[model samples]
Target: MVVMWMVTGGAGYIGAHVVQAFLDEGMAVVVLDDLSSGHAEFVPEGVPLVRGSILDTPLVEAALREHGVDGVVHLAGFKYAGVSVQRPLHTYAQNVTGTAHLLEAMDAAGVRRIVFSSSAAVYGTPDVDLVTERTPTAPESPYGESKLIGEWLLRDAARATADDDAPLRHTSLRYFNVVGSGRPDLYDSSPHNLFPLVIEALLAGRTPRINGTDYPTPDGTCVRDYVHVADLARSHVVAARALEAGTSLEPVYNLGSGDGVSVREIMTTMADVTGIAFEPDVAPRRPGDPARIVASGELAARDLDWRMRHSLTEMARSAWEARRQA
Candidate 1:
């Protein structure tokens, strides 16, 4: 029997990669995206695509039944942290309410397995240098809060289903900074992410503006753990497949490179990758920006057998390749 996989926001960056992974495994797949931030062209041709919001419960339930979906990869959400501060309500609607609708649809459809594309922002600024899955969540922005709430909902649903004699199992991968592109046909055009913006500025023959140069790090710039999108997507597949095979029961996992690279280091790597001389302008730090955020995904590696194959330079090269092609 073909396992039907329903991927919410499957047309987006990481979602597209997961969809491709499932397709490669010979699974019947259905993609649901609202196209508000995701592009339709990014979705692979010939795959089932449902252009709708996750908040639409009726539509989601209908798609679940029509596609015979057995599992779900939930990646749909309002992801811009900076924008979330400006429009908290919108983030709550898209991330919180939309997630609720998806869960309700899943419960109704009898789909008991899900792999959530969670964020590292849920940990905020941790007390320790290397954050683990056990780190206390202290999300600073509405976006982070929304994601935390989504995790809570997943846990609640899992409990509710267990009480109803139909338990739901989920794996929420908390990704830090997701950079690099997996598909040559797709790339992020948004000016939100630092990696994309750096590439774009370099391509335009301009200096990418650095947010701050007064952080406490050695380089006086903020540091972050950046993970390749492809690796992150693969982890989702591992989590989903494991759940289907009755392998594990962990609800959350951290997915990261473990080594924190500073903004200056990333800039240097990007310059080397594109052969473009970057002269970044020093700008004031944005409000609510964390000084440093890195994750230790030891649990993920030990449990899922996952590894980071892409380096800093490799990530910059792939991203630059996609930017140049676009």
Candidate 2:
């Protein structure tokens, strides 16, 4: 059975990898992106491209019906946590309003089965080190709150459309720090992500700035789970197949490496990967920065049969390679 997939923000870092994964598995893709934060070169050839916004209901609905889209991978939204705090209204408009528009379009077009890109921000700063899928959601910033709301929208949509007469089956994968590149041709440019920024600083012969040196962690810096984009991409594929097979039972999941690494560790790995002895400048902690936010994928594994397959070193190396090629 040939399944047509519609991917919003498919030209972005994570979305490009997901597009590649779907194509590799012999599935068709129709990418819808505005090229605001995403690059045109990242999208692969032969995939249908729609240049528009996810909030554009008529366009999204037309794409769904025209492409015979059976499933959708929703990746379009404002993702910068810091910026979201400064501009709460903007984040809500993009993440919340855009999601509502997408769901409405899907329902109108009679398309079922959606795999949504949620965030670890939903958990915010966890009280425990390894945050499980069962962790209580306490979002601190607008970005986190917006994504949490996105999850709620999916849940409500699924419940409303669960009847045989209705349409819409959905899975929301909440993840943290997605690093690495699936293809050098598809790397991010001037990204707000820490990994990309650090790499940029190193390549520019400047000292990378550390957020803080007074955190409770051993290195006095925050610890986070940095999963590879490829691994995350594979998880989306597994999710789609699971939904098709009636195997995925939950509408929400946490996708992470299940291990924590400090900011200093990432700097050290960047040096190791690039063979550059670069010094990092210690700076004050950024506002609203979480001390440590690591998540467990046990629930995802048990349900979608997913696992983290990439290491920290591999993650750094791939990003460094893409930087060099860029």
Candidate 3:
């Protein structure tokens, strides 16, 4: 009895890795993506790529039924935090409204489980050094607000259907900065991500610029937790397996590495991996940029088999190789 899971936004960078992780474990998967930010070529052959948005209840419900989907890994949405500030309505429409519609379709089609793709943006600039699951959520951007709302939707939906036969069982994984490549054929194509921004600049014969080199950190630069996309993807499968086996899980899990790497360190590593030795340009700090934001993945480690399998060097090298090949 092989369980079939539908991965929304599976054609994107992180989603593609998740799809591959499921397939690697001999589980079956299907992808539903609108190709707005996802690339069709990133989707592996032989896996059904349903071209649609999660907002379309009829379309999502049809796909769930037509494929006999037992669970869903919801990852589709407008994910840019900075841009979300300017386009709050669009962000809410896609993330909050889209999640609501997905849940509705899941209920209509009797899909009982889901693993939502959440973000660390839910905790906006925490004063603490290491973020835990219990940190207060104070989202600054519309993107973060939408994600928090998505989690609420899942929680409330589960509460509402608790007495039902197939009560909804779900968990939201709040991601930090997901980087690196699981496969060379698949790479991060986002223009906003730090890894890609640096890669793109180096490729075009330009120096990578580091924003805010005056923070109160070891290197006077912002420090952030960077997790390998593949590592993060593997945990999604573990969480789904737990749900399928009737194992109870927390409503939300933070997928973090409990380690902080400074922007200066990242630039140095990028230089080492790419074999481009040049100093990075220092620029003024971006507004609202926190000095550091790392998290303890102890809970996820205990429950979801989460671990940092790759080092900072591996992350930089893999990302550079994938981008170079692309």
Candidate 4:
């Protein structure tokens, strides 16, 4: 039997990678994205791109049925944590309300399995050095709150629909700081991501500024786990395949490096990769930014074959090369 998956936000950076990963696994894919933060060119050649939003129930339902989708990879949402603070309504509308609509459509279409693109923001500020599955969720921003609520919706939907139909198998992958490019044409275009920000500055011959130089970390800047986009996408594929095979999996998993990379280290690698030499201007720390938070990926690795396969240098190099191509 052939498997087909509908990837919402499939034109966006992470979504594009996930689409490719599905193709690599010999599955058919259809993309439903409004192109709000996504580019049409980012979606691969063969896949059908349905230019629409998950908030549109009829459109989502049509896409699912038209594509004969067996599962969904939900990646469409408002993701900027800092901006989400100011735009709480929009955040909830996209992440929370949009998810509700997707669930409704999926139920209508009888598409059950889903692999959600959750975030590390669910754990606002960790009490422990290494974040684990047990880390209590206390989201600081509306974005984080929306993602946590998304998880709840998926769980409830699965539970409520289990007895009526085949069980609605689902899992959410949470990680921080997804960096590097799997393909040059599909680079991360977010204005707020560290790599894109720095690369944009370098491309324009401007020096990038570090947000804070006085954090409690060794370098006085923030430390976050940076996972290669390719590796992250691969795990999503593995999870989808597991669900298709009727293998049980945890409701959630963290795809992160056990250790993290510092902001200073990232800047150094940026310089090394781009051949730009200039000390970053230090700025005051942004409000509510954590000094360090990295998650443990043991659970994901044991089940889904998750691991950080790219070194920092390799991550930086691929990101820079892709930026130049863009």
Per-candidate Cα lDDT values, in order, are 0.86, 0.87, 0.93, 0.91
Q: What is the per-residue lDDT of model 4 for residues 134-153, given as tens digits with 9 covering 90 to 100?
A: 99988888988999999999
TM-score of every prediction relative to native: 0.97, 0.97, 0.97, 0.98
Q: How much is 162 displaced in model 4, in angstroms? A: 2.3
Residues 5-50 of candidate 2 have per-residue lDDT tens digits of: 8889998888999999999988888899988898778889898889
- Per-residue lDDT of model 3, residues 21-125, tens digit only: 999999999999999999999989999999999999999999999999999999999998877877899999999999999999999999999999999889988
Best by TM-score: 4
Candidate 1's displacement at residue 49, Å, is 0.5
Error of 3 at 233 (Å): 0.7
Instruction: Sort by lDDT, best first.
Output: 3, 4, 2, 1
Q: Could you tell me the TM-score of candidate 4?
A: 0.98
Candidate 1 minimal-lDDT segment of 10 residues: 182-191
Q: What is candidate 1's lDDT per residue for 41-62, written digit by digit as tens?
A: 8778888899999999999999
Model 3 clash pairs are none
C-alpha lDDT of residue 254 in model 4 = 91
- List candidate 1 stretches off by more than 4 Å: none
**Pairs in clash, predicted candidate 1:** none
Q: What's the ranking of the predictions by TM-score, best on top?
A: 4, 3, 1, 2
